[model samples]
Target chain A: MAKTLTIAPVSRLEGHAKVTINLDDAGNVADTFVNIVELRGFEKFCQGRPVEEMPRIVTSICGVCPWSHHLASAKAADGVFGVTPTPTGRKLRELCNSVAYTEEHILHFFFLAGADFVLGPGADYKTRNVIGVAAAVPEIGKKVVHNRHLGARILNIVSGKSIHPVTAVPGGFSKPLTDHERDMALKMASEILEFAKFSIAWAKESVFPKYLDAVKTVGVIKTGYMGTVRPDGTMDLYDGKIRLMKPDGSFVDFDDTKYADYISEKVLPWSYLKFPYAKSWNEGFDMDLDHPKGVYRTNTLARLNVCDKLSTPMAQKEFEAFRQAFGRPCHLTLLYHWARLVELLYNAEYAVQLLKDPEITGRETRVAVKPRAGRGVGHVEAPRGTLIHDYETDDKGLVTNANLIVGTTHNNAPINMAVKQAAKLLIKGGKYDEALLNTVEMAIRAYDPCFSCATHNLDGRLAVRIDIHRPDGAVETMAN
Target chain B: MTERSPIGLAVTSVHRDPAEERPEPEDFLDKEVLVIGCGNVMIGDDGLGPAFIKHLEARGGAPAHVGLLDAGTGVRTVLFGMVLAEKRPKRIVIVDAVDMGRAPGEVFEIDLAEVPPLKADDFSMHQLPTSNLLRELRDQCGVEVRVVAVQVAWLPDELRGGLSDSVAASLERARELVERLY
Candidate 1:
């Protein structure tokens, strides 16, 4: 008789999720599903609200990546009003984006996924966490905390608030940077750049080599990729055309406003989150490991794969090394951590560049706008992945409709496929241990997914419980 | 004004010397008491925490030594920063809505020990690690921590603003409790 095994609320992720694996009568792995609870009320809540309020209101959607939502919403509002931000305004917004990326990348790489690499995946559960990482590598831990704090401080100076920022507006930035403030931000950003340099070097030296075997094998999938890039094919997190790349390295670029034409969302009965696939490929949605159709991934690895080159010199060098080792369109899921470090260095470098720009302190940051009936689509490369916000407004400036496709949602299908691949590869004849299970989780963690952003609905039910269904019609439950 | 203490807790103001240069992150912890309202304002009764903060503001806000913040869903960023900071507030009071099988609109205090250990290794703020981080702040960091909870009547399955009447009514009561923490 077949049996089922479940791992609920996969630990160390941003939000709640579970993995259910089925075994055949021979006790061999048959199938796997990653169930993520998604909130469905945000778009509905945006309806009837003034378009200007979206940037502020949308921040509450996910505390983990509010800056992403905030900036995307502001850009969407700018689209609704059909106004381009002043030069300085645009630079400031980009500065914030880079800073936010540095902060999130550090947190995810060092604290969240770091536990797995810093402490071996097989380490005892009790001693495998941020605290454990801190206890073991005291110096690195201190640097992590200090640098993370510095990112927040820079944001606080650039914008009035750091967490749920209100500084980015439809026309442009709400606050102007004083010379002194710019100096402070520049100094801190320079420091972050140094840390970014140190981070990738340390990982290359200490973390990646030790985990090379896992990196080459775990969660490996052959899917298309998507990300934002400049007209010249350079990675641009703040603004750019969307690039969709095939597994074979072929690609196409399109304006974000035309995203609906290229991407389509599929609803799955078991999971609340929607699976987004490359509709333009016309391959029809599928997640078969041997041949995935229209199933592409976003976030770090995908972004790195899609971008032709990195804008910053140091990051460009790292990108070249990564390509030389893994080749273009790298399918190694674990490389997401490596790709994330590259982006971290790029963003840190980008922040310093923006701050040093004389125009970053220009007085005219925003332009006046009148509420009008219009539709706007805005996209950004959030640390998790590509984030798109679509909004339509009436003449009265009230929101008539709203749609959002967060970065994590773009990887929904891929996440499921990766989880399935990992489960099938690691669990042989139903033999699995905590360490093995965690290694499987590392596959998912590599994406650094933020379920909090992917999920919009909340029912107040919180816990990680696993259920084992035996062939005898009996069930066993386990929780963490 | 008379100093107030809540059950075995002593409240005292620690003002920074005027001559000292105050950095930005430390400015947050400069107050003797920090009251943070944590919840999603767009999610039904979960909006109660921020609503309570608004209520306190409407009532002329807290004293100079107290800092009131509407953290919304971003409380983790603030709390996480605090846990790792060299300097921190003497006491932190978190106000949010909870469902503990109690009467709607009911206001109660949850001991630090009552915060469940939802995920032991989960450190992400988007998960249940907020409680874990809170515990860490209290146990390892030596910060006085307290929780003021309001039993939620209903949490909508869809995104809808405004709290249910019961939760909306409890805001004033919750405000009073938070004031007592200072």
Candidate 2:
């Protein structure tokens, strides 16, 4: 007899998702499925709209990481017009990206996944939230709130509005930073840098040490990795060549626009999100733990594994330490949290370095764009993962076709594999509790999965609902 | 003699630089009442809150001391900042659309205590965990909070913009209720 065990609305992820595990007559884990509800027909609606408005229009796709879509769309629109942003324009955009990264990483570490490591996974549900974290760790809570607020403030100053930015235009940024604005940004960046330093140290000293056992055992999988790197293979979040590294530590690099040549989307009947695999691998997609094919990951740990070095000095040091400790191509899923902290530090240092550059305030922020028919593809290392935006324009510059592969969508296959691994490792003999299920969720949150941008909705509902089905096809049990 | 001041309303976007040393913009910190339109205008009836705010601004008869903001979907950012800054308005009113199994286009006020617990903890900052934030603001921070909710007519499953006719029609009624509350 085959039984189906379901975990719907995987809690703490950005949007709704479900994980279904199959069991054989012996009640052992056989297979797993992750179903994410995707926003319907967004690209179809984008057709016929003027390509220039894409930055503004795409913000509504996901309220969580609107900046990612806004910037990526703007970059695509820039490619369409064949105009490069002025140096100042590019710096401002990168600055915002860094600030946004700090804000997001802090939120995830402290409020979302923080509860798991800070208070332990078995803590009562009521005390395992942002409010509870604050109560338990008031000192760190205060610092986290203040620094996160500072990040938001920096974004507000640079982009006019942080949530749905309209500053990035077709050719370049819309506004140039004044000397005063630059000075203010530097002050904020300095404070943010302090917090970023404090964060990584705090994680290493307190959080990561406690989770070492879990890191070694939970959701460990060997797969290829992907991220953006410069010519020298330094990590970049804004613009760079795409690098897809195999599990064996060998890799290939290609131009950003040539992603289609290397990647392909595979659709499953139960999931709304598409599974993107490395087409260049020549192997078909499979999530088999021992003999996986065409499976790779994106996001923090993946970026760390794929890049040769981080551009900033402090972050580079941290990366080296991480490498020496874990070895390259680290398979531990829980180490994603540690990798995220390293990136946070890199973003802060990078922002400060950019702000100090005198050219960041130059007047030539934008280049005039003349529209014509062409195709453009833009990619960015969004905090979640690699986000790509592809657009086509007609003779009049109206969008003819649009396609977006957000960060979470790229990890669809890997998430399913991780969830399956965790379930098999923990739920022996089909006996499990809420804490056991949460350990499975920890596997998903390690990716800091942001489905709000990958899919779409606004109902304030929790992700991760569970339903256990017996071999007889009857629903057996349900839990939060 | 006629009044010297012109009859007009001022509308402002919420994005601001914290470094600017500007005064309290006519008691923004101590206002007796603050009205916020909280919804994503891109969806159908969810635009009611912002629509009602627009209607009120066009009508222009609320008390001079009261401040109105189109917080849109980023209401959490504003509310969270206020919590940290300790500069909350005395009374906060949130206008939004909800489907409570009520008639379409119907406008009503929900007691803060009666508001149900939000479905899950918020995973994104674009939306605050509203029920929790509201309670925190009222109970912990000692501020008065109220909700002005309109029953939504439709929210498309796809990326469609603008409000439906029935929901748009309720704008006037919502404005009237806002005026009475002020």
Candidate 3:
């Protein structure tokens, strides 16, 4: 007999998710599924619209990561129009991406996941939130809040609005960076760089060390990894070739447009989100912890694992130490936090470097782009993972077809695998408590998957309900 | 090097050639009162916030002291900016839609004390956890927060834009209530 235990509306990480774990006759873990609600035909509705509108329209796809969608769609449109942005245009876009990443990563590390590490996983539910984090670690909390604000301000200066940005257009950015704006941006970038320095040092000294034991034991799995990198194998977030790396640190690089040939989506019966697997592996999709196939992770750890080196000096040093401590292709699930900090430092340094470039303040930011019929693919390493936007346009420049594989979508299978792995280790013989449940969630949190972006259509009514179904298929209890 | 302003301290506003170019970060911070309409214009009935704000703006606009923002599900970021800003609005009036089993188009106020606990904690305009930001503004930052919610005729099943007739009809009244708040 198999009993089912369901945890609905998994909390805190953006959007909604439900975890269903099955228990065998002896109360041992049997299987698990993470059900996500799919967005209501956003890509379908995108068809027939003027392709130029994509960069603007896609911003609404997810309020949380609009900058990623905006820039990715703009680049795809650039591909469709067969035009390259001027040096300033490309640099501005990259700068915005870096700033946005800094904001998102800080938000996640301090406010969202911070509650777990700062306050302890077993802390009272009421006090285990952003406000709680602020109350407990007031100084760090202020730093997080202030730095995030600075990131937002930088974005506002670069783009028009920090949330639904309109600055990135098909050919390039709409506005030119004036001398005054350049000076302001560089100053902010330098300050952010300092904070980035402090953040990585703080995390290493105070946070990662305490979690080493949990990192080794919780939700650890061996899977392939994916990220974007320059031709020289340096980590890149804005634009680069896609690298698909195996568990052993070996990888293959492919053009961004060839993603369809390497990846295929698997539709599971219970979940609305599709499981993206590496079709290139020739090993069909499977989520078995012991013998998973075609499964891979994206986001921070994946980017760190797939890249040969970091571009910035400080981040390169940090990366070296990380590799020294944990061999290449680190299997520790919790190391994502450590990897995220390193990337944060890189973005900070990279942003300052870009701003300091003479060409970054050039008056010509865009090239004239004519509407043409063509297929185009664009990708960016969104703070979460690799985000790909593919589009086909008609001779009249109307969008004939549109497809988006957001960063979170690529990790759908891996997230479920990680969840199951953690549940098996923590929920032994169906013994579980709130604290233990949170520890299990910590595994999912490490990946920082955005269910909202993965499956954009949520009904807005999210309440966490736990349902325990007995072996006889009768629900023994339901708690909300 | 340009002087980098300290956290939670007022910074000098950047001057621009076009006087009416989109407001800068300083403008967002300097508002004495903010009336932000929070909702998704893509879902039926959920577009109440934008609809109400639009009606109000069309009716001879708010005073300079009152910054009327069409947040459009991006309230979280706006509120986050405000939370970290050196200056903040003394009052923030949020117009939104809620389905609490009330009559269609029925408008009501959700008291600060009535906000449910932060489950997801991530705040948004069209989502439940949005109340967390309002609470934070009220309790932590000392910004007076008020939510005016219209009983929605169920949000559309698909991504159909525009408001339901009932929700649309109630926009005027909702606008009036919000105007009174400011």
Candidate 4:
């Protein structure tokens, strides 16, 4: 008789999720599902609100990636009003995006997933967390805290608020970067750049080599990729054309305004999140490990794979090394961690470069705009993945319709596929331990997914519980 | 500057340079008391936290030694900083609306040790591990942590703004209770 094993509320990686694996009579894995709660009513809530309010209103969607939403919504509002931001305004927005990416990437790499690498996956559960990482590597721990704090400080200076920022507006930045503020932010960005450099180096020298075996096998999948890049095919997180690469390394770039033509969302009955696939490929949606159709991934690995080169010098060098070793379109899911470090270096370098530009401190950051009936689509490379915000407004400047495809939503199909792959690979004949189960979670962590943003709701309760369903229908539940 | 205590506890030294530790422009530790409201304004009664902060500001805010912050859904980041900071406020008071099977609009105080496990998988800080972070601050860092909770009248399943009538009315009472903490 077949039995079902459930890992509810998979620890870490943001938001709630559960893995349900079915075992055949032989105790071999048969099927798997990753169920995530759905967030409803955000679009309905945005209806009737002023288009100008979206940048601020959308920040409340998820505390984790508010900056992403804030900027995306602001860009959408700019589209609705049909006004481009001043050059300085655009630079300031990009600067914030870079800084925010640095902070988020650091947090995800060091604190969230760091526990796994810093303290071996088999380490005791109680000691396998941020605190554990701090305890073990006290010096690195201090640096992590200090740098993350620096990120907040820089944002606070550049914008009035760091968490729920209101600086980016429909026309441009609400606040101008003064010379003094710019100096302060520049100093901090330099510090973050140093840390980013140290981070990638440390990982390359110490962390990655130790996990070489795991990196090559765990959660490995052959899927297409998605990310944002400049006209020259250089990675650009703030603004660029969207590129969708096929599994075979071939790709096409499209305008953000035309995303609907290339991509479409599929509703799955088991999960609240929607699976987004390449509609333009016309391959249809399938998560089969051997041959997936229209299934592509976003976030770090995708961004690295989709971009032809990194805009910054140091990052470009690292990018070349990565591609030389892995080749175009690396399919190893765990490479997301390595790719994240590369992007971190690029963002840090980009932030410093932006600050050095004299125009970044200019006075004219925003332009005047009149409300008009229009539709706008804005896209950004959020740390999690490619984030797209679509909005429609009336002549009165009120939002009539709103649609958001967060970075995590795009990876929904990929995450499920990865989880299934890991389960099938590891749990043969139903043999699994806590460490093995956590390895399954490592697959999800590679995506650095934010279910909170994907679902757009918060209930403030998360606990990990696993239920084992026997052939007789009896259930045994376990929690951490 | 550092020492190991428990697995999940924060270890920070008390005496440190304010300039070296504070995150600039906002010296939360300079205040004797820190009061933060945590919730999402777009989520019905969940908006109580920000709503209460606005109410407190309308009433001229807290005293000079008290710091009032509307953390929204980003309370975890703030609390995490405090835990790792070399210097921290003597006391922290978190105000939010929760459903604990009590009467709507009921104002109550919860001891830090009693915070239930209600959050998980929040990348930055949503709610569950916030309690854990608070506990670490109190037990590991020696900061007094208190929770002021309001029983939400109704929490919508979907996004909706504004507090319910009862929750709105209780803000003043919650404000009074929080001010007394300072």
Better of 2 and 3 by DockQ: 3
> Which digits, one per residue and each the tens of the lDDT, describe model 2 over residues A274-299?
78999999998988888889999999
Number of backbone collisions per candidate: 3, 7, 1, 8
What TM-score, over all chains together, does every model reach? 0.91, 0.88, 0.90, 0.92
Candidate 1 local lDDT, A244-299, one digit each (tens): 99889999999999999999998765666779999999999999999999999999
- Fnat per model, in the order shown: 0.29, 0.08, 0.12, 0.23
What's the candidate order when arranged by decreasing TM-score?
A: 4, 1, 3, 2
List per-prediction Cα lDDT, in the order shown: 0.83, 0.78, 0.79, 0.83
Q: Each prediction's Cα RMSD?
A: 7.4, 6.4, 6.7, 8.4
Interface RMSD of each: 12.8, 11.1, 12.0, 15.5
List per-model TM-scores for chain B.
Answer: 0.79, 0.76, 0.78, 0.80
Top-DockQ candidate index: 1
A92-201 per-residue lDDT for model 4 (tens digits): 89999999999899988988899899998999887787777889898998898888888888888888788899988887887777777777889999999999999999
In angstroms, the error of model 1 at A184 is: 1.3
Best by TM-score: 4
Candidate 1: lDDT of A333? Answer: 96
